[model samples]
Target: MIASPSTALVTWVLLTTPAVEQPALGTCSMGIQHLEVPPVPREKLALVCISPGQTTVINFDADLAMDSMTLDGAERFTKVEFGASTVKLIPSEKLRPGDHLRLTVRFKDTAAPSSVTLLLGVHVAQAVPFVSVLRETRTVESYQQELKTKNEELQKCIEENTRLQVESTGPGGLAELFMLGLLSDDGISSKLLHKNFVEAPTNALSATGLVSYRAANRAALMLMLANKAGMAPWTAESATLTREGKNGMGLRVLTVWQPRPIENSAEDSILVVEVKAPDDLQGSYTLKLWEAGGARTVTLHGVTFPAP
Candidate 1:
């Protein structure tokens, strides 16, 4: 007669056999597992779980040579049977938790990876009953998964390219003024300025030529400066535009462009500063420019922008 759960409870109460000590730590597999083993040898070892009195079978895709089988703790197992393409192992009670035994076997036929290795760990919770090792073989499901992954990546690339195309055709700066109908037959308004209009001390850099321009919603000033202080590789760090008696407020500076840095020893360089201008951008203003190290500065007064 087979013993039911209620009968098994009575048998457990009558029996006083010592319990087998379990391992303290192990992430044991709870069910049968399938692993695809690469043909090339890898540094990482595949794992298998084994418990006392539990039978664990390892099935391989290729036949193994019986003579090439090797197990680290072969004597500790209750029974170990090696067939043509399978290895059955029943661990004994002496195999305790935290013990990791190595099992290795070579295939009968010559292959790129001649041998397969596995780490048999004594698990405390559950043992893996079976493991199917596929060597250099992929299922149809694997190919479908790969195709799905590639499709997702291609979709992301298409979306990114569309976004770039839309931005490329959009209006950005002065170069795209024609798109906004700002560049008409009148063209951009320009005015020439002279040295008498400069207010700051011209000891480090002297402004030789000054030109101011005004468009629909933008204003710009271009200045040619002679490097009198011989500052090597001078770059304009900041520019500010402000009306007289404004004290703390200033106009919105858009951008400053310098083709190249002003080299040392009396080299003349060109600098352009652009600012945001509304219809109320009339009258005189002060424009100041400072070098990278703040050692040299340029300031101009009576700077005016003409209407578009």
Candidate 2:
């Protein structure tokens, strides 16, 4: 004998409707020809709020079974809680409000008629407000771009300043400090000026004078030095001398002072002197010399390289 058709309505209470249906089927088959369900109004809306540092709770109408309601936008469902007829969807913390989702309801009851199913559509109402992370990422990227631009500008400024400084101080500004008296003593013009034989001319030859020659200009003198031809050079700085006049030739002597020593030895000494307007004058002038206890003079002759 066929049993009477049983219809049970679940109560609307509690969070998610845990049980899928009432009156366990116990492996029974039924072809539900038709299913007529009343419209679940929007006024009967459900909401789930997930606040920071708290678990999310979703409450829905109890008319639907635990598996009846579907979450369309959820990536992964955590744990589903079910009550009498209501169902709750617990999703990852990534859920937020205003996101669209669709719900489909289905079932089978063979005792009704032929195979039939029931379906309903519900719009998403209120949802949890996830911390807006995309906005924060955009802000960070903008700040990084601005910082990069500032660093580039600073580097450019430094490079330009360095270039200007290098140009202003050229190779000619190194040394400018002396004069040299090149006196080929008698027939010993072939004499090699060794440190041992030649002293750092402190006392000019007083009894016998000597001829003197100076570098082209102060800039050029910075590169010339005394004892330069010797194996070891003399590193003296400021130097000058003048002697008695003889036969329209003014005697020229040599005087020298020391400069601050340099480890490189190249910056040690210099000869900065220039003849004013007399480049063509090759007349003999006595070199006014001052020895330890004597004195003398000689001629400083030169062929002019045509006045500049």
Candidate 3:
């Protein structure tokens, strides 16, 4: 026969040996959701999460065992306790901009072959003024270097100008000046030559102009003029002069000149110079002119005139 519920429970309890109460096996999972170390100025960081139970014991990995953990006021700790569901880290010193914290956390009874690692990077919220100042200093230095280079170039140009001015005032200066002036863009001197001398339209006789010589030392003046006019490329053929008559303190002379052939023309050109010189002069007072490359006049004085 079936007994009542209370009677059956009592009988079952009496017949079976008394079973002891056992504690439930608990579990925990720990991780970090965000790895940023907050800029709270010496505040503790809740960087680790422990779910469902209080951690009875905590340990660090072998590599981080000695001095890896630090507290806000305490230097280092191997084991720390948290009665709550989360673990908080305290720093021994206030965190500055760009500071980094690295550590490993091994949870008790966690099903894993290795522990979790934590890397906390800290950055200041405000702008750093020193960075701007450094950039401006570099820019100023670059500008100063550029200015120094420009000053050096300007000094070189000034020196060159001075040297040319000195050369223009020397011995054959007048003759050189006259030749350069003929080539000048104003065309005043060329027009004057065209007006005074008989025009010969030939490739060799490109252009002609006249100059006056006062002494018998015509060779020196001719060499100086050649050097000043940069006429090293042309060859001088001959120079011939005919005496006209006495004029003032010197004899009137006419010079017939020829030079080597120039480019763009098959034949060479002839030049003429009319000058007056003292009768006692030993050397011939003849001036020769020719057009070389780029229509520049090449001159040689005291050269022998070629046969007609």
- How well does model 1 score by local distance difference test? 0.67
lDDT of 3: 0.29
1 against 2, candidate with superior TM-score: 1
lDDT string for model 1 (189-239, tens) is 667665547666643677777777766665677777777553556678667
Query: What lDDT tens digits, residue by residue, belong to model 2 across residues 270-302?
Result: 222222213333332222211111121111222
- The ten-residue window of minimal lDDT in model 3 covers 127-136
> Model 1 residue 75 lDDT?
94
Any runs in candidate 2 off by more than 4 Å, and if so which?
1-63, 96-98, 103-308
Stretches of candidate 1 above 4 Å error?
A: 1-175, 246-249, 265-267
Identify the leading candidate in terms of TM-score: 1
Report residue 228 deviation for candidate 1 (angstroms).
1.4
In model 1, the Cα lDDT at residue 185 comes to: 66
- Please count the clashing residue pairs in each candidate, in the order shown: 0, 34, 9
Instruction: In candidate 1, list every pair of residues with a backbone clash.
Output: none
For lDDT, candidate 2 versus 3, the one ahead is: 3
